[model samples]
Target chain A: MQYTVISLQGLSTENCQLKTEKMELKEKLIASFMAFENLVDIDLPVHDVRSEAIKEFETQGFPSKRDEAWKYTSLNSILKHDYSVFPKRDNHIDYNDIKKYFIHDIDTYKIVFIDGKYSSHLSETTHDGIDVCLMSSALTKTKYRLIIENYFNKIATKDSLTSLNTAFSQEGAYIHIPKNKLVAKPIQIVHFSTGNEAALLVQPRNLIVVDENSHVQIIERHQSLTQNPVLTNSVTEIFANKRAIVDYYKIQNDNENASLIDSTFVNQKQESFASVHTFSFGGKLTRNNLNFYQNGERIDSTMKGITIIGNKQHVDHNTLVHHIEPNCESHQDYKGIYADSSTGVFNGKVLVDKDAQKTNAFQANNNILLSDKASINTKPQLEIFADDVKCSHGCTIGQLDESAMFYMQSRGIPEKEAKALLMFAFSNNVMNSVKIPEIKQRITKIIANKLGVNIGFDL
Target chain B: MLKINNLHASVEDKAILRGINLEVKAGEVHAIMGPNGSGKSTLASVIAGKEEYEMTDGEILLENENINEMAPEERAHKGIFLSFQYPIEIPGVSVTNFMKTAINETRKAKGLPDMPANEMLKMIREKSEMLEIDRKFLSRSLNEGFSGGEKKRNEIFQMAMLEPKLAILDETDSGLDIDALRIVANGVNKLRSKDNAVIVITHYQRLLDHIVPDFVHVLFEGRIVKSGGKELAHELEEKGYDWIKEEVNA
Candidate 1:
């Protein structure tokens, strides 16, 4: 019952017991839900749904290494900070200061949030053809009530952190594409933490639905402005109807004090296609929980990621693709480069039901360690009850090829540039699949910058 | 232009090159012919500053400068090029881009700016054309899934582009067909000049028929046991290397 009793025993036995006692982050968040309910209407669906979610969080606190899903990543290091449950949102940022973080070269529909508050001046949301707007309006508006009630938390798993986000979170992006409609440009959802509090915790929720024969592309990012500690628990639900095409990208390049736990659930219907690409370059600790469920036949799911980190930073990618119908296919490829003392983990799972016959699944994870202290743990799990399914997986961990280095050097290329080129070649297959030219170009520049080289041309 | 003074080298503590003392003057093509495990490739790699090959004792002099302390790229900037037997496959980098990076890096080392794009393209066109390479081949990833003849031709194309002062071709004719062999040999012959030297290391006497050598040396057990004019290669070709091994063991 008393987690910090050992450290308290060494302190003075004072008279003020209330001041001496410290509240756990779990207890603070559970208590903050009450204040959260007071601000909104008491009789609305939000109050009851949030109350149920808080109960789930109270029952199951933050996950530990003992859990099978979190065997490699531990939340204890980030949970030790005394984060403010509610942060002030009076900070106004200059657009020029944060322009580099977005894909600014091309026009994009931006849904910008600063310190957990929606920024109207920085956002460009419209309701002319499709519903591209804020989650607050989606959750409260009468016209959006039925759509939200039907799809809002429908596909998300019952994970503890996701439940916690659903309990206390109130603001994020809500995108809905009508049937047979393709958005003119890509949409960017960016969350910036201003470091207004000593330490802050922000939970964001997003819901995206693509109707039949529609197409959509999305890019998401989280950035912290200052060095103060910040933790963000975000959840996103995506629905891809029949014959729809959806492409999603997650870019994690926050500062050292920032940590993120992102959970995304995707549902694909008959003859639909969905893909998610993650690029992780910087973070103190980042955990990605991505899941895909095939609802109908002949669906395609693809997952790809490239991670490069150093200096004690950590990143974990946990993904699952469930095949509920027959003739579905899934592909997963991830590459990581760790230097200094950084660590990484990749846990991918594929499951097929008994009736899901003739399914094909492939997974590959490759990593390079630039320093002896850097490490990675990769695992691929497959559970197939259908006898006609084909599943394959491979994992590799190695250093830069010595003979390749010597070969390049003999061709008059320096050691550093040669290494960067080899890394580019390592991740070339995944980079080739990016559809947006501007996004691909931006990612190339970021990869070059992360490698500390000035590569100005296409690979 | 190149001198190896009693060069002693080893890989993983296993002595591969023992007391190799050979001098190659400018404008001369020196053919090193030997059987398997005769240190022919080791000699080529040692001169190119391969880190895995430790030079235990002796010196490698290029144009009167000791290059034993230089790194591989440094040696390359000084105009030493090694055409590997199996060229590395660098995916996602086209042949043109690889050549541009290599040439620019060398130029940058020599206190010059990057070559203009038009001039670089022109040089690539000239070199590739001289080798009779297909224009479509230049845009593909460098050596990835390439045919053996294509790989060899690409290697020669790169050699022509760099134009090193001391060119060491290590078994460049192994994986090539006869036509590719002729084209590659012609490319090498065209790049020969009065100021640069060439060291041709091979196991078969077939490639020497095209790229004729001025001097022929027979290597056995990490040492050159016999040295002669071009007639020596013909003699070795007529009679196999068993005669050389018998002579060395005697």
Candidate 2:
């Protein structure tokens, strides 16, 4: 947010214009909710949920820096964009043009969207052994009503941005794996903003349910196609039943004019496992609110992220693990590399209930600032009510090792390439957790390119 | 051939190598023996163009060209190799892949195309086999989790791959067992040629027994106090560095 100078006498014309624009953006969204209500089925339970959510958004308004949770991130700058609350039309794009962003080297199920609407031509969904389809279908269809009534918006916290996203939740991926079933291939739910509007805000909601003894892998991304400003407020809800496993990855590499505030809520039953890996390398302003609720005993939760960014871009990773039952474990490891004037924030909070005993939680955040102006704010908060819990957290911020640089250079690698190699090695441990080869290859290329080195040989 | 004329260098504003003069001709092996903190490693680093070492007043010439302005990698491309006493561990970069990058970078500096993939692999297999390195070891991260002897062996493996015109072994034998010492010294001897030279920097005479030097020089207080034939190494080992200190103080 740009804080322009103001005279004590009165408001200037430019300041007035920006104020009205932001006010109009918020007012416009509130006004558009009424019109938006007419487009969907008012008979479903989600409609009431949406109605209540919009009211809560109206009461809370957009968050400011005053909120402790948002002390390091401010939305005042992106709010100035006069965003179109709802996309008007879908922009047709060729497959060749957008193919590079997908894991095209391998065969998988894809749920593609243009702006906020599903693009059937580019999607490869399945209903053979699992239900990998659209949320719109799950909401309006009669067969999915029971599941929707039980799981929709069940675990999402009622924060202002999440409430705003839920208020207009429509059109996103919905996957349901039955008991004793294993998804043969990974699922990629990619949202492409055509940037058809002068300024745009798209809200995509995803729901996933994995039954007992089931396993699934899903990848998510949000991309803007043009230089026009785009703001995305997305919410995803996942429920893992007993002995179920879920692996979800989010790739946030959008155009410089785009911003994203993604809120994900994961609820796990007994003996269930859920892991979320976020690769944040782009976007003008990105905030991830990931919350895991271990509602049952013996649940395992994992969170890992690698954020490499430059320019004026900013990324904030806010995570929480709530242990309500006993014998649960959670691990969080996030690494970031910031150059130019970019900034990053990592706020991880872990809470253990009084009744929960023998809980193990680990948190680590390490960062490298390549430029003097680049910065990072990291904090780890643990509130343990149980005396028998085990918790450890550590964070470090520093530059590259000079001796290591000279070591590589003396081996004939240039200074620029040597730095890239060290940076690549710094994040390589997290990459080891990825099971998919094609995804690994894509992330490797992105890291290499971002580090400004070709690395012609395989890693 | 490598030549240094009144070379003066320092690190962090502290003088390390003060008024040091040395010259090594091709086809000759020179041994630099010094006590602890005698600026032996500093000379190796300065010759390899380590940025931390500030060259205050000196001239380093390689093949009649002044190399004071060259970067470490640039000096490396000019065929000067310094085997570090303590090699840096770079995780996620396999030994083979690191050698490939180093070879390609040096070739690129010399305006040559990348070596063919098959030739590179063949060369790697031959050199690795010569150094008795396991095939599995080639794929592990460079120097990460490697034993002391393994790190020293890997340095020689790199030297074999680069085949520099001048090779400086900085305490390459400090951490090696008898078996590993013989293997590492054998690797260095195999690469030594009439067009290349070797500079062995060590504190003891055991490694000098394997990689025998033609000339031995004693460094005291950043200056070569005495130069002599190979017998000087035995005298230093027998009498210890106190004799050199006594001689220099006298």
Candidate 3:
């Protein structure tokens, strides 16, 4: 197969050729490109954007080991053979298969994206205290277009994958909670990826705005209905205005063959509070990026993450906490329990800008390796431009405490039971941070199942 | 009843317990007193099945049955308890939960049913009261942030709850005020009976004033150099361990 390397100044894409003997994939990519051209106006201006994106894709070779962000996990195995980026819409998965991920009775606000396409049929349109709608539809409406155009793509890096997301940004969800108004129930957003013919790439964008003195909760669920190798590139941004409070949770429990690159961006204003809780249990390869920006005085942000990896899977969590104003505080605690021959990586950074005194920032990443083959590479960095700030970071990557394990085992607790008990205790430290009772319980059940412990929670 | 015949143990190839012999019958209290580095604690730990001690040559019999192959918990199920000099602090697990799990595990190993939570709570209440432990203290994490006196008292409380047939108190009287020592000794005395035996391991003879030992044995270089009635403890306390060194030399 012929290959072309596209380059545009500093940004570039590498050339690639089909390795598979199959001849049908060429027709699939051709058809997929044609479908994209048919959906959007192929005018001169739009053509330039598409050509630029494709050129970048060619030059970068679809982001591999050379890329700093994608160093730990290589997508070469994913694109090794002839995989179709765009396949005919399978539509074979029943709605019930994806409905199980939905959270019910959560403030009654629902936004559903089926097969990466926003579905109005499965969503609730009207809400008294919040505005929930699709970004694609909202962009067409003059009133909401201004907000979408101004904020979209502002918080993410200009990488090939993010650019591709914007290049094909067809459907997404936008939620705005008015000032002083509290959403009684948590907003539930579900992203479903379907099709088993080939590789499916789905990018779901979510934007949540909490005005001054407002309170809201957002629960995001990412799942792939098919057992095939699917790729999900998801980005979520949240804004907490002065004195506002926001609690965001992203639960990634997709198929084990699926890979995901999920990022959460949070901005906090004066006296505001923002927290993001992530529980990652599935996926063949997963990377999570959480960035918290404290922009006002007395603002606080916290990031909590728990990752349980087994088999030969790989999971990485990278976080950055920026203290831009004075008297801001941030804390990060991420724990991982790995078994089999899996690998886990955690890279956390905290930056205190100049004049941001009394910042009070702390970061800790701890890992428990259940098997000798399992390994973790954790790095916690702190950059302080201000001298009077209190900042500390620590990373620990080791096997389960043998002393503690022996202590438990000597009590007649079997080896497996003792290990599970210690793991449960290790995970509970982060799970307890979820203030919402139902959500906390649900997370506990997920951890219990992953650790092979029977806590007697009926699903 | 237990017997240790020519017990020899070492740590990292350094001989610590050499040719130590002792025996205890039911309803007998034997105090094994020794100077620092004389392996008094090693004897207690080896009996409790601590893995740090390498048994170079020894044979330990519990009711004439060899127990060298058994694990610590199995030995515990066979009625062996050791009051740690320094109890470990495990965070986020309440004392009640730790005790209940320990008790049920021992019971299960003995083919006994696990106690109900209510019954366990009642037992903990009674034991805490006997040890002067506050009700709220039982709800807190195990030994975390506990005072020295409280930790020692909690050890006694656990001893009361376990009701082992062979109890070994290793330095339980260390770092305690006169009042706290009196309270702890009183608890040990109250729990003593003919069905179970107590082994008080201490450097000082003050604890024996309360829980009197039937026989006091002075352990010198890992062997009992002198054995006598209650008067032996008083003599060691008054004349110091220098007298035992001279006697061994003679």
Candidate 4:
């Protein structure tokens, strides 16, 4: 197979030298790669892949507004910060102090990271029947080298951010569910930035593989512990083999000083199912790049998200579902509530190939702008090449239903609470499909907290 | 229990309710009969303190307390309820949960604690049973995918749960069939007491046949043109609103 370098706009060879002359962050990152490599196992077989990825990132620097995919999300403002690429020392956090961040109500396998370094004291890994450990272990251990070689950095796109993450992919959660095994407890991948530096930048890479006739559920989150500036460029690649079931949930409720760029790539084999739910409640800026590729027949892919933000927060969701097989189905539903000067964007694209006959794809995005200044830009694109396929997309942007507000208020609910209830109810359709009760409750509480209402019951 | 004096309201500078005056005492059932665009619904909405209609000059007194400046929820806290003509479908909120929030919020406004779960369940069971609603209906989303009759029935069910001092039924009989009308009217009749009043706003006399009104007022061109005993509804039904228009013109 021929490999082509897809350079981001404005970062071609002609401008690369000029861009490098400024000693931008991209150049800094590339210049520091040698030191970063020396700190890790440089003799590993994955070194060549890392070298290629950094070169790719050097070729395609930080994406700018000129790029079509990055048009709605601007990095010019965030890139101005002189981020500390590496932490000076290891940071320690008491479990009791940060217990609220974890879903403690239920038992879960946790792989916790502090400032991009795996915290063995805070994590609970298992090696009984499956591999629920760190990527560093998987990379160095002889028993897991083959698996890591087969799966790591396999499905991620060649985008600048993803390549940046791949270049420094030293520590993250690595889970391998063997064939015909069922993981009883859900696995939680949490990355906490201690803000030890004035401004910190972390890239965490996660890999999950569920073999044939296996099942697994994973939850991932990125948190910042302080008010200092922190930016996280994370990538996750999931593979579901034949007849496998995988459910992934991402909770993005960091502080206003934190920004995240999450890129997730999912590949489904024959008769497999994969679903990812993203709940983005807080953050200064959040950009989600979610792509699903159906590789075999009778596969199911689902992507759902709910975003509620206020203040100057910005969130953009760019999703694509590529149907490459016959008799497969994909569903995408996203709901957003923007208030204050917040802005939201939803760009969903579904492509069905000619050979993918009888494919069913559906996409829906609905937004509610609570303030005059709050706005949303939503677009749903469908490119269908199969004549026998069923593809539909719907997009809606509007304010809360006035009549519904009156109806609730007439029932003695205050206007504030009424608005909160309506907003919650508007996103409830996406929440109803949450299979885990604890996660659902957590989401409900976050929503209630964001809405500033003491709703006693689960809406 | 309720009084409206010289009420003039408009929306976007278009007069919808002009000089509407009415009075209702406890233990009295008054029916406001009119044709479409006669402002029958606007009267109900204004009494419930809907903000869409600007009341230019009016006094809506509930038990002699001026409520014109109160919010809709404040009015509700003062024991005033208005059953919507077109009940809004609140998706994802079960009927039981919606009532729980409403009842608890009302109780909180009254400086009372949340109603106990058992007590709330009991009241829900009793009210839902009285309205002939199925047990399964209480668990579904509030009014979403509900039949027109089911929507009206759910509205009444909410009214029963609240048990307001004054309940205004706005076009409750519009989309209901005869059977649904009988059931709804029976539920209303059972809830009516000597301490609470009912103002039935309808376009026809069919609903009044089930729940007899103590008095009937014909509203024309945003004003109460005629008022009489229950016989006025029968007369309007026989003459079909045109006669009332002619009488107002003359």
Candidate 5:
């Protein structure tokens, strides 16, 4: 009887309420659709895109904690708000202004993206060792489309965030360096968001492929031109073929009001090397997932990250380094500094598969809390399925050493200066991984400014 | 230059220094001799303001100024140096950087400007030679992987660089070969002057032969029960600490 009564009530009122909500959502979606239609020349079908997203959302239940990739970070906070998807912007972004964000050491081939769309007008080509192009143009080139279709979203899953990125995947960059070629210079990929449009969502996808015996360094940086609350969902995929060397860096320095969700997947072949460094400095809520797989013998992979969270910021880093072949090695180091009610979470896993004998893996996560209310949850796990492997993982969560602090204080460093010095030194382990001078200096300055200290390292 | 009046201290709940009294004027070298657990090291650490040890009842003065309330770094600025029995191992911090920080901090506390890097490097080189410390050691991490004798030599090198008015050598001669002892003693003797004093705390009399002390005090049960000239060290070495315990009780 109760079920019959509920069914009658549901049939009478559900259609009307559902129609009203749908209308509201459609109105907001139309505004964004019109904005993008006016801004970019690309023919991205907005109606089809929204219908596909709704279908996926109905099946996936909004990507909950049950999903392995999104376990540590929750999308519930974002889905709770009825947010309008942001439209693309056609505003002009000076390439010269964006060049300042590149790592200014060694020669570099740059691919610049303005307001979620590739800008070929701001890019240049060199005769040295590599080919760089915008992803949209690469799709039209026909020769690279097979490689793009094969590897795009191959390693990344249809988790809530990546699904969202894929659903709106419109613009980004593609970099390819051929075999036996040494680029000698780093490649800088700069993405800048502009315009006063509120509630904007930008999706930037990058695919970097280094052929056999090749070497390249790529730095991907994301910056915002305004303080509005924008949502950025980005995905990057990298392939390091046999004997190839790739050093990839991702820097997220967006406005404090923005939110970011980024995922990077790397695969290495025999004798290949892949090193990834991530620096998280901005965003109200940021989540980064980095996965590196060593699928061949003697391959080496290193993943390093440093995050500074202050003023009610929330940052989460989830990383995995998998050793699937014999004689492979992996090292991971991530550190965080939290102050002013900020929160940081790090969960790293180092897995050594069976038959991967003689594998060596090490992982460490260290955090220092400067304010009493700040908190950090760090977990470094090791799963060694082989008996002959040497694997160790450890995490440390503590305040600044009182003895070390007193030691510094006794040396006449004031209390505030002493604390800042220790905090800076703590992050030095990860900052030292930067190979470029100007980029390192800029990061150092940003860190100093965030901590309210003077510039001590020369850029 | 230094005065300790009835200094009593403890670690945790156990008392170590029991009503210790000592006075050292400029140009004097005093040797504190005792067996293990006799509180010789405790007295040195107490003077240097180590926080683990609590001062129960005591008064320490430098030039008639109360220094009992000062922190270790402040004590360092006031020209008090303690060569730790066991120097700490600090990784990733170079000896040069550590010494520069120490010296600069002391100088800043004394209302002095920071020293230029070049001049500081020069001073480090000179003092390292006097202490028989290799110049390359300054580039390495502070006391990291340092041998027993190397740590002692580094301590003396730091002392020579700081040029403190009152130097407390806490078992500086404990973990050294004959050669290292001679080098360390020579370093200390070279640094001695009329405007400063040195207090050498040791368990054995072998170190006193290299840098002879002007006076010797026998510390039994945390208090100095006997005092004599430098020959007192020879007597303590010959008869051992048991004889003094018997004599004091008798």
Candidate 6:
């Protein structure tokens, strides 16, 4: 199959001007590459990959509306800011001040980053049977060289944003689970932007490899400590070996001044199961590019997300599931609630290869618009080359069910609470599949908080 | 202890309830029997303060207080309940959670704290057992994929939990088998007391057989044409609604 790469200049003049401005930012990023490399080890083998990535990003500055893959989401406005590539100093954050961000109800391994640098005082890493440490260590240390050589940047797409992240990759979580070993506790990767700069841009790259017959669960979040403008361009590549099980959760509920571009790539081997759940509640702008590649038969790839936004918040979810082997299955369900002038986009594509016969792929995108100004653009695309495969896609955009509202109101629930309950129920299907009880509860609390309700229950 | 004085209501400029006058005393059961399009359900909805209906005239009094301007939930807090003919299916809320929210909201409106968990659980167990509902059914999503009988029974179960002053069962007997009908009627019978009243709106007398009503009113073309004792249901059953329609037209 052939993929077309549309030129950014083909767009309208307005978009072209925006892209031109972003091109300046891209030059600034290219000029700062030497400074970034000077901070890290220049002799490391990963530096070559970084150099190549920077060259690729230079060739493709930033994707614009002209690109077919970026038709619904535009990055020109966010890229206009002159973002500081690195913070001048390491900001200290007291654990007591930011404890509310963590799921304190349970014990788990945590990899914490403050202002794009690792915070040893706030992080808990393990070096026992499994490796749960920083990507910087994994890149420099000889003990982890084999894993790094085998899996670093292996499955991540070479898009301009991802390439940019690869060019600036220095500090993020790096986990390696050995064969036949199950990680007892879920790992939490949290990056907190202190907002010390006028406008800061942080690129965090994570590598996770779970070997055969092992299981691991990971929760990742990007939070902003202040109202200053902070943009995070993060990339995570996960590889699940044969018979491996991996559950990944992303919680994106930051302040209004914060924006994120998250690119996650998952490669699953034979009989492996990998599920990624993204809960996006608050942000000025969020674009999630989630891709799943099934490399072997009987693999299961599940992608689910719930987006609830109000005000002028904008969220875009662009997902792709590529089924290459026969008998593999993929399921995608996304639910969104847009209120006020908030806008949402869901572009879900499932591609079944010719040899992927007996592949069962189902995709569903449902959204509710609360205000007259709120809008959602949802498209589900299924490309099935195999005649015998079962591939179906469905998309719906609607308001809240009036009858359901009346039912709850008549039962003594107020209008606001009733609407909240209906919205909760609308997204409850995805929440039910969350494996960790504490994480599920935490997400439920965040949703309730977003809805501005103190319903005395867990919901 | 409910009274409707010259009640006239319409929906979208189309008149449905025309000058309805009725009274239900405490410790009494009133069965409002009518054929289709006779406005029986409209009267129930208007009495419960369904906002779609425009009460163009007359007053609805609950315990001698006018409730025409009250919201549905306000009326519910004031001891009014309307069992929907077709219960709405809420896909994600469990039956128990729905009931819990309903009960707590009502309590909070009355300036009372939420019911304690153990007490709430005990009440749920007792009421569900009264309706013969399985323990597993309480955890299922509210009314989603529920059998017709299960939906009706769940309605009565909620009525039992709320213990309202006046409960209106609108077409509750429809879509229910004889066993489910008997079970639901038995649950209602057990909850009936001198301090509360019930208004059963049905086309058939099967439900009245289990929960006997003191007065049976025949409503035709938005007006109550005839009112009698329990024997009126038997007469209406023996002779269909045609007699009542003919009498009203004459």
- Which docking class does model 4 fall in? medium
- Model 6 lDDT per residue over B1-250, tens place: 8999999999999999888899999999999998899999889888877788999999999999999999888899899988999999988899999999999999999999999999999999999999999999999999999999999999999999999999999999999999999999999999899999999999999999998999999898888989999999999999998887777778
Q: After superposing candidate 2 on the true structure, give the runs of residues whose Cα lies further than 4 Å from its correct spot.
A: A1-22, A456-459, B111-126, B132-137, B177-179, B239-250
Question: Model 3 residue A314 lDDT?
Answer: 85
- What's the candidate order when arranged by decreasing DockQ? 4, 2, 1, 6, 3, 5
Q: Give per-model TM-scores.
A: 0.94, 0.93, 0.84, 0.95, 0.81, 0.94
| Real interface contacts reproduced by model 3, as a fraction | 0.17
lDDT of 2 by residue, A1-459 (tens): 112233545535544555666677779999999999889888877899999999999988888666899888868779987788877876788989999989898888999998888999999999898999999999999999988988999998899999998899988889999999988799999999887888888999999999999999999999999999989899999999999999999999888999999999999999999999999999999999999999899999999999999999999999999999999999999999999999999999999999889999999998999988888888889999999999999999999989889998998999988888788778877788887878878888888888778776465
Off by over 4 Å in 6: A1-13, A456-459, B242-250
**Model 2, C-alpha of A172: deviation from truth (Å):** 1.6
Consecutive 10-residue window with the lowest summed lDDT within model 3 chain B: B86-95
lDDT of 4 by residue, B1-250 (tens): 9999999999889999999889999999999998899999989999998999999998989999999999999999999999999999988788998999999999999999999999999999999999999999999999999999999999999999999999999999989999999999999999999999999999889999998999999888899999999999998889898888888898
- Among the numbered candidates, top DockQ falls to 4
Q: DockQ of each candidate's interface versus the true one? A: 0.68, 0.72, 0.23, 0.76, 0.19, 0.64
What's the lDDT for candidate 4? 0.91
Error of 5 at B178 (Å): 2.1
Best by TM-score: 4
lDDT of 3 by residue, A354-421 (tens): 98999999888888887887878777778889989988787776677765654544444445555666
Could you give candidate 5's per-residue lDDT for residues B1-250 as a string of tens digits?
A: 9999999999988988889999999999999998888899889878888788899997999999999888777787888888878776665567877677677767777789888889998998899888878778888876779999999999898888889899999899988999999999999999999999999999999999987999999998899999999999998899898989998899
Model 3's C-alpha root-mean-square deviation from the true structure amounts to 6.2
lDDT digits (tens) for residues B70-171 of candidate 3? 877788778888887777676666777777777877777778988887999899999888888899998887788998888899889888988888999989
DockQ of 2: 0.72
Selected candidate, larger DockQ, 1 vs 4:
4
Candidate 3: CAPRI quality band: incorrect
Docking class of 1: medium
Clash count, candidate 6: 0
Give residue A217's lDDT in candidate 2 (0 to 100). 94
Q: List TM-scores of chain B, every candidate.
A: 0.98, 0.99, 0.98, 0.99, 0.98, 0.99
Give the local distance difference test score of model 5. 0.77
- What is the C-alpha lDDT profile of model 1 across A1-459, one tens digit per residue? 001122445323431332222237888888888888877666768667778888998888778665899877767678878888777556788999999999998898999988888998888888989989999888888989888888988888777899999887578999999899988789999999998898988899999999999999999999999999999999999999999999999999999999999999999999999999999999899999999999999999999999999999999999999999999999999999999989899999999999899999999999999988888888889999999999999989999998889988999988888999899988988898898888889888888998888756466
